[model samples]
Target: MAHFSYRGRSAAGKEVKGEIEANNLDLAVEALMRQGVIPLKVSAKKQASGLNVDVSSLLNRPIALEPLVIFCRQMYSLTKAGVPLLRAIRGLSQSTTHKLLAQTLDKVHYDLTNGRNFSSALRSHPRVFSELFVSMIAVGESTGRLEEALLQLANYFEQEMETRRRIKSAMRYPIFVLSAIFIALVVLNLKVIPQFSSMFSKFGMDLPLPTKILIGMSNFFVNYWYWMIASMIAFALGMRMWIGTTTGRERWDLWRLKVPIVGDIVNRAQLSRFSRSFSLMLKAGVPLNQSIQLSAEALGNRFLENRLIGMKTAIEAGSSMTVTASNSGVFTPLVQQMIAVGEETGQIDELLLEVADFYDREVDYDLKTLTARIEPILLAIVAGMVLLLALGIFLPMWDMLDIARGA
Candidate 1:
């Protein structure tokens, strides 16, 4: 099959031209005619603008959650307003500004024109649409409640973006402080210490231990600066490669939860994601086992995902959900109790939503206080650096003062 650009007149005798995919020119022309276009020309479609291509964007650009949220919101409004699905999709395809999403929607629109369902067309764009997204849309299509599903997805993605925003904002001050500390250290090691060491050498005096140690560090920095940069780059690359592996990822995920002050927040955030996804899927009529699997995988924590997967296996093997959840050790005690109550009442979906909200609130509170919590640590670090500089650079100067008095 190939793409063909065709120029023709519509049924209303208005000029219409567009690209279509078909086996050959004749088939492309035939398809155009069937759409009520009196085909006058048909030829192979070529890239319209070679200069518009960007290697960086092609390699690094990813469809962000914001676009997906907006897409769902738009689709929800259009569908709720009683627009025809194909027309709505085609309009969205033309209107969207994001190049990749627009192109993907164009293909989806073409698929819909070819008698494929919306979910099936979406399933083909796995990079832009996750498995959870496709599954929810499939359920919506099957149950004739597409708008609700779209709304739910919009809310989910919006919350995700919000959480990310909060994390970045909370981290800004700490990042700045750390950068300043690094710069200060570099200056002291390269310039301040060397100047002091040269002056001390001219005196032909025996330097104190702190002064000697500082001089040695300065010499290393001047001679081995390139080595330091190369080591940093190599370490970063090595870590990236290691984290890309399954076992390495699992270990990293588990280790993150052991980090002080931040681990609890990360754990709760992932649990919130899992509960929210599971709730959304269940509310959309997805089976419990399937929801568990998908939600667990979406958490972005391999260790927790494995534990949740075990819960699924247990459920499949006739164990009660509450029992499996309690045994999983991934959830908090309060959350486990909620699950038990939700099971007893047969309102797991609603209860899971509450669990998600609870976690969100906890995460929000923790983020708000993150700067307050981190400031003390940063202050301690700066104080320690100041003490070291005083001892290393100033202690020897006092000894030299005594020698000058003796002379």
Candidate 2:
């Protein structure tokens, strides 16, 4: 296929110019005509230089979640109000706060003017439009329920962002405390411990075991700080490389699900996403196996995704969704019972939605209690560090005091 830029007069006598992909100029002209355009000129679009293209892309930031959510909500409102798709996109392109999104929507409007469907235009920008999103829009296009689809997408994105916000907010305190502890240890090793060691040496007294260990660690830090930094960088890179591999990531995700308080939060969040996405797909009339496959990706947990993929395979082989979910061992008994009942009553969509709501509530409660649950553990860690510092630094001082008193 070739991309052709064309100038045309629309049915409303408005002049428009845009690019379209087609086999040849004749076909491109035919496409424009089909869209009620009288083509004046058509020529192949000129490609920009590679450097210019690269620089432009580098400067184009990805759209943030809030703006995208607003875009969806606005799009639903506009479409539902009977505004034409092309006009709606053109207006949105002018009004959107995100420059990249605005530019993309402008191009989408151009594509629509050149006879492309909305979903197809969106599909061109894979970096912005996810497969699940594009697929949902495609269904909307086919079923003439584009507004409903947009509403669903808006709600899904909002919920997903809210979950992420809650998790991050809950974790902020622990992260800050851990960072402070790390900095304190570094300062002690690099400065305070050396000073104490020199003073103890002047006393000509034998240091206690804790003081000796602390001095040894201080020496190591003073002499080989470069090696320590290099080791940390290497370990980080190695972990990244390992997680890039499928098997390693699978193992890591599995381990994550076993972590105590954090794991419960992660599990509930993933299950919430799965239930919601699966419910959306089912309501949109997506097939069971396909819905499972898409929901697995949407869940954002490799371990659960693997299991859900296996469940899809099972369903394809004539197993029921309830049985497959139960056998997977990832869900709670309540979820399993709900699925079983949903299947029996053929209200799977409603039940899945309920399951999503239940998990959302669970995650909300977890977020509220997260700091409370973690505070004691953090206090214990702080206490341990303080005790170690006291023993390592102050214990030797007692001997120095005794010797000074005798002198």
Candidate 3:
């Protein structure tokens, strides 16, 4: 299918402008006609040209997740109210002021009109809708309950956003402390230390080791600031490239999951995501094996994905869900026990949702505790650095005073 930008009028003679996906212009018009929209003109969307289309531009693009969540909620509401799918999509698209999102929905509406499945159209833009989202939508479509699925998706994304907001809030103190340290270091090296170096030179007094080291550092920073900045930029670029590679990403993600206080939060967050996604898919009527596959792929963590894949293989071999998941070694004993119980009771989906809720609370608690603990530690480190700099400068002045007294 291809995306077509178009202008048309509805049955009420109201003009509308939007994009849609179709095999061709004729198909596009046909699709619109099914929705009671009379197409006036249609043209295929042009693909971008040149090397400028890269990861940087993609990352720099403004992503309004809140607006997306709102859109999902509103669409779910509209659909639940018995609005026709095409009309619902068009109404939602027309209501949005964001040009990119409006155009995207227009295309999606067009695709839906052309008999393409919702999940398939979503998969075409992986950057916008995630795998978990499309999978759930596919399940919803299969069950003839797309509105319910959209509501669940909106809830999931809202929870994800909250988790991110907590992490960012927790990091704020450390970031502020680090910024202060950098500014203090810059002032000491550029202004304060240089004057002391000049005074020591005129007095012809040999400085202490700490003072001498400080002076040397100050001189180097002053003379080679550009090189330092360039090297920092290069290091950041190299790190980005390295992390973009499969091996590097796996290694880094594994390391991240092993870090001290932060690792616990990360693990809990991932568990919450897995449980939530698995439960949602299952409740939406997706098959067990397919749900596991899609949930694992949605994780974005290779290590966890491999473990889930192993569980999938075991399940296909006739192993029970609880036994297969337990053998994966990634799930906690509590989770494994819950899964076993849920399977025995024939309430796996409900139990999985409970597990997800439990983990979500744990993540919130751990994040709060982590933030409280990290704040003081960061402050202490910054305080120690400042104290060291003060001593390095003031101790020399004290020695000079002692020398003058002796004379």
Candidate 4:
């Protein structure tokens, strides 16, 4: 299908503009007219040339989670209020601040006008909507509970955003401090140490071991700087390529969950995501196996995702939820007990929600204490670097001063 950008007048002769996808421009104009819009100008949407396109945008132009959460909340309100789906989408398209999302919604409205189902229209914009989002919408449409599904989605996305915010906050100070240390080391190696090395060479005396090591390091950095940069770039590219593979990704994710304090935070956050997503899907009337699969996708940890996928296989083969969860080794004993009780009581949704809440509280506590735990470690590192620099540079000067004073 081809997309057309059009300008027209509404039934009240008010100016209107939007995009529509059709087989051809003629069909697009007809579609507009069917909406009671008089088309004054209609043309196929132009694709930008490769040279004019921003390559960086392709890599990082993600729809922000908060905007998506807001969209879900607004759609839920509109759907619940009995607003026609097309009109609701049009309103959203007009009011949204995110340009890409607004454009996608405009297209969705046009598709809905042309007899496309909501989920199918959403599927056409895979970059803006995920498989889980489309799947939930499809389930909602089939069950005639789109409003509830959207509301659940809004809450899920809000929690996801909060978790991300906490993780970023936890890492921010350490990243800043480490970056500062890196910059300091680079300046000392390339500029400061070399100046000191030149002065020390004129003394023509045997230097201390620390001073000799520092001088050698500075000389290597100055003489082989290009080689060092190339090596760093190559190592980065190699690591990226390795992590792109299935085995490497799984190994890396497993390693991440074994890290000191950060690992616990990541583990709790992933479990929280899985529980909440599973609860939302079950509440939306999705089947258990499908909900489990979708929940696994939400975890964002390959290790946990694989384990959950295994649990889905086992559960589908007549194993109980508790048994499968225990075998997965990703869930805690508390989580397994809750799932068992939930299964027995047939209130799995509520129980899963409770699990999610429990993890959410744990994650919040971890975030609050994260900096306190990390501060001492960072201080020790800073002290070590300072001691090394002082011993390496100052110790030699002390010896030279002794020689000059004939001691």
Q: Which sequence of candidate numbers ranks them by lDDT, best first?
A: 1, 4, 2, 3
lDDT of each: 0.87, 0.85, 0.81, 0.86
lDDT per residue for candidate 1 within 153-205, as digits (tens), equals 99999988988888788879999999999998899999888998889899888
Model 2: which residue pairs collide? Answer: none
Tens digit of lDDT per residue, candidate 4, span 323-347? 9999988888998999999999999
Name the candidate that leads on lDDT: 1
| CA-only RMSD, every prediction | 10.5, 9.0, 9.1, 9.7
For each candidate, what TM-score against the reference?
Answer: 0.85, 0.85, 0.83, 0.85
lDDT of 2 by residue, 347-372 (tens): 99999999999999999999999999
lDDT of 2 at 166: 92
Clash pairs detected, candidate 4:
none
Off by over 4 Å in 2: 1-62
Candidate 3: segments with Cα more than 4 A from true spot: 1-64
Ten-residue region with minimum lDDT total, candidate 1: 6-15
